[model samples]
Target: MGLILGKISVETPKYQLILKTADYEIRTYPPSVLAEVTYDPALLGDRDGGFMILAKYIGAVGEPQNSRPEKIPMTAPVITHSAEKIDMTAPVVTSGGGGSTPITMQFVLPAKYARAEDAPQPTDERVRIREVGERKYGVVRFSGVATETTAADRAEKLRKSLERDGYKLVGEHVLARYNPPWTLPPLRTNEVMLPIE
Candidate 1:
C-alpha cells in the first residue's frame, strides 16, 4: 500500500497477517530495517524518558556527520525487548535493571530504506541500523493500561494459550506499544509477542 506524503505516494513494508483468534493473531513480517538504542534503566526507568532519548537519536539530534538526515516516518507499534526477568512495578521501562542487561528500543525504518545497507547511517553512536530478517510471531493483543503486571500477565496468557493449542514457542518475548504517552490507556494498542513454530 502507498502512503500519502504531501501528494507523493510511498510504499511501506507489507506486514502479513496470517491468522487470528479471539485473543491473538499470528503474523509474518517481511525483512525490514530498524534503528535502535540501548538505554540504562537507572537513567531512564520510565517509558517517557527513554522514548524522548530514542526519538532524538533517530532524528539525529546532536550527531555531527549527519547532514540532510532524512526524517523517516515513524511507524506503528514500537518494539522493545527486556529479554528476561520482569518487574511488575516498572512495566513500561522494558529493562528493569534487575540484571546487567539494558533495555532495547527499536524504531522501524521506512520502506524507502528497506535494506539496512540502503538506510542512511546514523552518526550518533547510540543509534545503529539493524536489518531484521523475515520472521513469524504469535501476538497477544490487549487494551487498557499497560502496567508491568499487565504485560507480564498477557505474555503468560499468550504462551499458555499457544501451548494449549499445540503451538511451540521458540524464542523469548517482547512488548510492542502502538501509541504515544498522550494516548489514553483505554485506546492504546499493545501486544506481547514471541517467535513461534
Candidate 2:
C-alpha cells in the first residue's frame, strides 16, 4: 500500500502581538494581497458556489491561469464575512437587514505570492485578486463554528473591549478562520479582527 500523508497547513499572515486585554488582543499585520469574490448572498446564498468559483481560479479545481499557479497553499478559516475598524456605539451590522447583504469571501495569498500581479488570475470572472494594506487590529479569540452570530457577537465584544481600553477604532471587523470545516470543533481557531489607529 502507498503511504498516506495528511493535509499540510501553510503559514498564516505575518503579525505581531502588540497588546493584550482581559478578553482580547491588539495585533498589527503587514500589507498583503488576497484573492476574493464579492457576491450578494441574497441571490447566491449557496456557500459552495462561491467557494467553487474562487477555488477554480486559484487552481483548487482547475489548471492555473498564471505561469506559477499550483493551488497556492490554502490559508486558514475561509472568510465568508470579512472586513476592518469602526464608528458609533452601534455594531453597524452589515448583514443588510438579515441576509440581504453582499458577502465577500477571500483566500489570503501566501507570503511568497502576495502581490496581485504576482498571483494567478481566476478563470472565473467572479474572482479577483486584490491587495490589503497593513493595519493594526483588535482581535478576539473564540472556538466553535465561525458563524455570523458568533462572529457578530465576538466583534461587538472586541469593539467594546478596545473602546474601553482607550483605542480609537479605525476599521470594520473581519472574520478569520484557521482550520478547515472538518477540523475537530474544539480544536478550531477563529478570530474577529477590527482595525485601530
Candidate 3:
C-alpha cells in the first residue's frame, strides 16, 4: 500500500470524524449499474442519489477468495489533476442527453481498477483512465445502509454545515460505500462527499 498525506477533521452530520485530502486513489465507473444511469454529466444534478459502488483504500487491493467480492480499502484522500482550489458550489454542467448517454466514464486510475466485468480488455489502452493528481473534498461519515433517504438526510445536514462555514458546494454529492454487499447492512461505512469551493 502507498502512503499519502491526509487532512483529517470532524463532521457532525453523521457524528463521525472525517479525513480529507488529495493524491489518494479512487475507482470510477459508468453509471450503468443503475436504472437512471446517464452519461450526460449534466444529468448529475445538485441533489444526491443512490449508487452501487465498491470503494476502498489502496491497501486492500486483491482478488477475492472463492470468487467472493473483493474488499477494497479506501483512504481519506482524493485524486485530482492539480492542486488548484475548486469552486464547490458551481454546478456540474453536462451536454444534454440524447437517447442513451455514452458509457465512456468507465476508467480506472493508477491506484484503482474496475472489476473484470466492468473493465475493458487489459490491452485496450484507449480507455481514458489516469490519476487525477490532486483533489479537495469534504467528507461526512455515517454507519448503516446507505439508502437514498439516509444519504439525503446526511447530505442536507452537511450542506447546512458547509453553508454556515462559507464553503460552496462544488458538485453533486458522491456517495462512497466501503463494505461488501453481503455484509450486515447496519455496519456499513458510507460517506457523502462534495467538492468545496
Candidate 4:
C-alpha cells in the first residue's frame, strides 16, 4: 500500500526522521528553496487565496515563468504559516488585531534546484523565492479536510506533546497538506509542524 502511494505521490521535501514518540515525530530537514506567496488572512480567510497565486507560480495554472513558460512539477505538501512581524520585509505586513495576521504559503522546490538561484523566477513579484537553512521540527500527522479550527487544534496538540517531552519550540506552528482538494478526506495527508530547538 505504501509503495502504491509512493508511485502516485507528489514530490515532498526530504527529511531524516530523528525521533518518534506516541504523539509526534522529530525530523530534520535540509536546506531547500521555496516559492511562496503571502496574503492577509482577514481578507482571504483561508489558504485558497495564497494557494492560487503559488499554483500560478508553479505553472499549475499554466502561467509562464521568466522569458519562456516553465512548468514546474507540482510538489507536496503545501506549507502554510502565519508571517512573523520580524520577517515583514516583504510588502505584506500583518498588524496584530482581529484576524488580521498575514499568512504565507510555500511550495518546496524539487531537489534538482538546490539553491534559490537554481529555481526559475516567478513572474509575479508577490511570489518570492527563498532558501531556508536546515531545521528540525516536531510534527504531528493527521488525515482529513484541514480547516482552520482543525489545524489549530492539531497544532496545540503537537505543541503540548513537544513541550511535555522537554522540547523548546522555536516558531509558529506550520500546517502542511499533501493532497489536492479532490482527494478523499480519509486518504489525504496533513501535518502540523512546530520548529524545535
Q: Using TM-score as the measure, which candidate wins?
A: 4
Q: Pairs clashing in candidate 2?
A: 77-177, 84-171, 84-172, 85-171, 85-172, 85-195
lDDT of 4 by residue, 90-124 (tens): 22212321356777889998898899888888888
Measured over all alpha carbons after superposition, the RMSD of each candidate to the real structure, in angstroms, is 5.4, 4.0, 12.3, 4.9
CA shift at 197, candidate 4, in angstroms?
1.2
| Weakest ten-residue segment in model 4 by summed lDDT | 88-97
Query: What tens-digit string does per-residue lDDT give for candidate 1 at 10-115?
Result: 2334669999898778888888888777766666655434565556655634432233465556565677776355442234333444434577778777777767
Instruction: Name the lDDT of candidate 4.
Output: 0.78
Q: Which ten residues in a row are the worst by lDDT in model 2?
A: 1-10
Question: Candidate 3 — worst ten consecutive residues by lDDT sum?
Answer: 49-58
Off-target runs (Cα >4 Å) in candidate 3 are 1-130
Poorly placed runs, candidate 2 (over 4 Å): 1-8, 47-49, 65-69, 82-98
Clashing pairs in 4: none
Residue 80, model 1: lDDT of 76
Write candidate 2's Cα lDDT for 1-197 as tens digits: 11012132657887999988778888998988888887765566553336666666667666754445667766655665532222434343356224455567888888887578888666567788889888898888887766666777788888888898899987677777776667666667788887799
Q: lDDT per model, in order?
A: 0.67, 0.70, 0.37, 0.78
